[model samples]
Target: MREIQYEEFEEKIIEIRRTSKVTKGGKNLSFRVVAIVGNKNGKVGLGIGKAREVPEAIRKAIADAKKNVIEVPIINGTIPHEVIGRQDASKVLLRPAAPGTGIIAGGTVRAVVELAGIQNILTKALGSTNPLNLAMATINGLKELLDPRKVAKLRDITVEEVYKGVRREGNA
Candidate 1:
């Protein structure tokens, strides 16, 4: 698949926060934003940016997200297998769902999974609720996906042959 252009992808603003720090003279103010970039076609990325203004933070987050994009292995609008991804104190569990199941997830995990073009999935946040960590963990889960074709090649067999005997009417 060809790489998706930055302009062609959709940008979703995940969160924005105003942070303050105590200094010698006064409190320092800054804005932090989490942004997700995607084409809704098996590619997505998450990025965090901090700046003195909200717009600048969002722009920076988008740019960073574009640079960090990853291609997901989409199988019939869902993941190929179940996976649990962990980052720092956060953990995200991902599972493939039947057609029309939609995305079963919360704010952070849902945003990441949806942006990755997964139409049917089940997600659960296992550990931390931190948006940043949760987003990273979700990304990690996608990264771990293995393509069935690649696995078939590695095993010296055709894709359909890999499941031979798993069905009741196999080889009939």
Candidate 2:
């Protein structure tokens, strides 16, 4: 993992909803913000924050996001493999694309992927279309990515063997 300063991360506000609560004191209004943060170098995070003001809510969200950062394995500006991530009813399918393909995705998915330093990718959002859910699903899918070296080590094989799809004589 690369050690980066907090200021190096890029932040995007996915959604902001004004919520109200009915109580003895008439109604209480608050703003809820969904935030995505990334360093564009394989690290990203998602967060939600609520407050009476938008700026404060955004600040809180950014802070929360920084705390939940996850590392993504990016290869040649794309993901290592395909994956599907789920959050509630939202499902995000992430596929690696050839170089120069750019990012083909919806607004929410694009923000997350671009911030994660992915220049080429394809994404499909399934089920719920809610911005918060979609963002979470994208992050979840990225979190599921596996590095080739790690996979090879776990399987007791060389990295080249993992890519070549060659099986040992004794192994299935």
Candidate 3:
């Protein structure tokens, strides 16, 4: 198998927050970052890092993202089918769009699909609008995508049958 390098990925930071811990020695301050990394060729990842400084938090996030990388199948710069992902109270609905439509999404969803190399898509952010939850929900949706060839093999059918929705009676 070919190894994927982090250097090939583009990184985007979605959120940065300053957190405080009340302690006897005054308040301990820290930074939290949410980041996503992608290679724009069917691979992406999301990570969160917390640290005492911004750069450290970002660095940690990038490293964590690299470890959790996922493969996103892109068909003509869009997903092969519609999907919905849920993270806590946040639900993201992803639908493939016609060519030239571009990505119609909000902040977090845009970052994820763009990095995943999807060029045309429509999205709706339902329920909670929290950035962290929304980002996680997007990742979950992408993760649920299955390659058509793989699906055909699993169902003992041809790739054309998978696309045409023609299921073999024996297999069904």
Prediction RMSDs, each to the true structure: 4.0, 2.5, 2.2
Q: What tens-digit string does per-residue lDDT give for candidate 2 at 21-120?
A: 9999799999999999998999889999999999999999999999899999998999988999999999999999999999999999999999999999
Q: Write model 3 residue lDDT over 1-172, tens digit each, in one string.
A: 8775665899999999999999998999999999999988899999999999999999999999998999998888899889999999999999999999999999999999999999999999999999999999999999998888788899788988888998666766
Clashes of each: 0, 0, 0
How close is every model to the real structure, measured as TM-score?
Answer: 0.90, 0.94, 0.92
Q: How many backbone clashes does candidate 2 have?
A: 0
Give stretches of model 2 more than 4 Å off: 1-7
What's the lDDT for all of these models? 0.90, 0.94, 0.93
Tell me the tens digit of each residue's lDDT in model 1 across 38-98. 8899999988899999999999999999999998989999998899989999999999999
Flag clash pairs in model 3.
none
Which residue runs of candidate 1 sit more than 4 Å off their true CA positions? 1-7, 163-172
Ranking by lDDT: 2, 3, 1
Order of the predicted models by TM-score, top scorer first: 2, 3, 1
Which candidate tops TM-score? 2
Candidate 3 Cα deviation (angstroms), residue 162: 1.4
